[model samples]
Target: MSQPKDVEADLVFWRRLESQRMEVDFTKMAPEKCMAAMIEPDDVRTVHIQDIRGKETQYNLKLNGFQYVWHDMPELDGVAEQSHVENVVVPKTEALRELSLIIWSRTGATRTVTFAHRVRCLSEDEAMLANNRAPAHSVHSDFTPAGALKNLESVVPDVAEREELLKRRILAINVWRPLKTVQRDPLAVCDWATLNWQEDRVTNRMVLPHGWHELGKYAFRESQGWYYLSEQQPQEALIFTQFDSESEQADEGGMTLPHTAFVVPGTETLPARESIEIKMFAFL
Candidate 1:
């Protein structure tokens, strides 16, 4: 067997938060990830991020807080290039909402509902550069508990109905997929079940266009396990959670997952990764 074997490419963590008191300029849009200009960038480490692409049963959303699944969307290739919010994004998001309901075993129950609130369209092309977002190169969660609750206020208008949904369970989910084949800068998600929340995560303030939002950054520990899918196609979607309301009360499974984008080794010649991430919530 003399086939050309691929060389090993390792990933280093670039998520050390800029630690120090600094004034933020509110004029600019949100910085991708929590990477605002800062005083110190400390303790960047080289870590092995396992590629579990071949293992189908290793991780699932219910336990690992993240899962990779097969989905069918053939028509969205050209639609992604046009980048139409209502035309392209709305329909894809509705599909994701349906997927969320079907996989979690809470479909068509009394008051069970899922809806998307925000969507981020990322690409390397010049035409889609309005938001100026590159893949977030740091490990972080999209929402903190306070930020999720604040986001809920904007999504759910009726106060009484919001209160009723709050009584059961609330979940914040990120549905991410590549508009094309992923050539470079694949995403890596950490196993939250292995992490000690109070000891392993740090809350950092991110300045958004609207206001500041709280995001969780990681403190790298030997106990933590990180993984990334290999060669994800357009029809594949990675579903994960950023906030789980019952996280603290649980013994295992159902918690927030933190993730980041990293350069795949020897992929410099390939096209840059273009993907869309839809952030949504489920009330059950």
Candidate 2:
């Protein structure tokens, strides 16, 4: 017998370059939604974007200037969707003269998606004085491509430390589905597991299935957003949720038992390395 392939899609994070760094918040929007950030100076030029969901995984990052073009997919197959981009432009003559951005996407339907962002007078006189010198060309020349598919089971950060850090934080694993309904019932079950590392060996924080205990204040929503904040450096618990096919399993308002943390002793009890696969919708 054959099994269905696990659901997973590429979610891309796009950023448009401007004079200064700005924060883009999606907290107020639906959790599953994807967006972009474009900083501008005086307006006149709105950042350009063609798609928020990308057709390909390849990303283009231009040097000399900080401009990013991202491509990812939407979580749901068919539902009314909205993508927003925020801009924070600084006024300076020597900074940057111009900036442009573009985002686009492809759904199963024939409809096309595209948008743009731009900024004017980015390189003014006074701005030039505050501008920082560009980094050494040798550093920029390092040709390292971005966006490589990674194994879902691969350990993140320091697993040993993560186990101990998880004690103080809420740890949940999530998966995204195509949509939310009876048709995708199997995909809706989200299982979160908490773990203790200092007490055990090999690995610390392991995914718990059929077991949801020791979950902290962290909450995971299907259409909301996911976060992981830790007070410890090497070891810390996190909440990794996104608008992916596997993200649905962790959806809120469920009757399932609350998540709890567990610990295993020594390296003998640990599995060599098992890949825990979960489906995600778009890349967020």
Candidate 3:
């Protein structure tokens, strides 16, 4: 028998269309759950079904699925930071079509994040279309609760007393980064609030070294998030911001953000290195 030659296939055909891009970050989902088992329909995000893929596809996530969430630094923490590994759901869509997942983060002062997708083929049994390959990236977006405390204060009445109760009840908060990477950190930034705080318990601070480098004099302030590139090998790195929830009870003991934006080490005027990357997937 003659030996058959191995054929190579074009991987580019499997990409997703750029126009279909949607925000998938975990920070957009409200009443987020963590490390919990799936249960009621409310526990999931209902994704409407469509014939875009062909088959009468009904796409929904299993109960208690894992997800990555983002949010602003806690009211107690000053910098803009991100939270990860939050549980989320894809609401049931009236018409079902295959969905893509992605993770993204920006660095430097300004960033131009771009992604691409392409359709592969249609499935006969499934009666829907399928991508030869999944998109390079997808996000698990968040839905933060708006006016969680404001509404509570309205019911309670006493301004100061209501404020204290709301702050203590705030399990977490989420924030978004509107600008892309540039050559420096944003000097003035605004973070969205979940539970409003009247007191200065939630903070913001910035620090700089003096003289000929103060050895361990890290920035300690003015950082929204943190990043480390394997390409750069330096045992020492600066801590932009830190949140301590010792006084108030927080969700699983921390805060959340949309995504961690990175900044280069050393001088504060250099564009961040772009070696860091995120890969997405859907389990069988």
Model 1, TM vs. native: 0.77
Error of 1 at 194 (Å): 1.6
- Per-residue C-alpha lDDT of model 2 across residues 1-284, encoded as one tens digit per residue: 12222322112111222311223334443323312221121112111112212221222111111112211223222222222111111111101111111221212211111111211111122221113111110100000011001122132346774444333312121211112111211111122322111111011111223221121111222231111111111111111222122222323321111111111123223322111112121221
Candidate 1 has an lDDT of 0.64
lDDT of 3: 0.20
* TM-score of each prediction: 0.77, 0.16, 0.18
Q: Rate the local accuracy (lDDT) of all candidates.
A: 0.64, 0.19, 0.20
**Each prediction's Cα RMSD?**
5.0, 25.2, 24.4
Which stretches of candidate 2 lie above 4 Å from their native place? Answer: 1-160, 179-284
Ranking of all candidate structures by their lDDT, best first: 1, 3, 2
lDDT of 1 by residue, 263-283 (tens): 666776676677877777766
Sliding window of 10 residues with minimal summed lDDT for model 3? 87-96
What tens-digit string does per-residue lDDT give for candidate 3 at 67-151? 1122222221221122221111111110011111221111111111111112211111222112222111111112112222222
RMSD, candidate 2, Å: 25.2
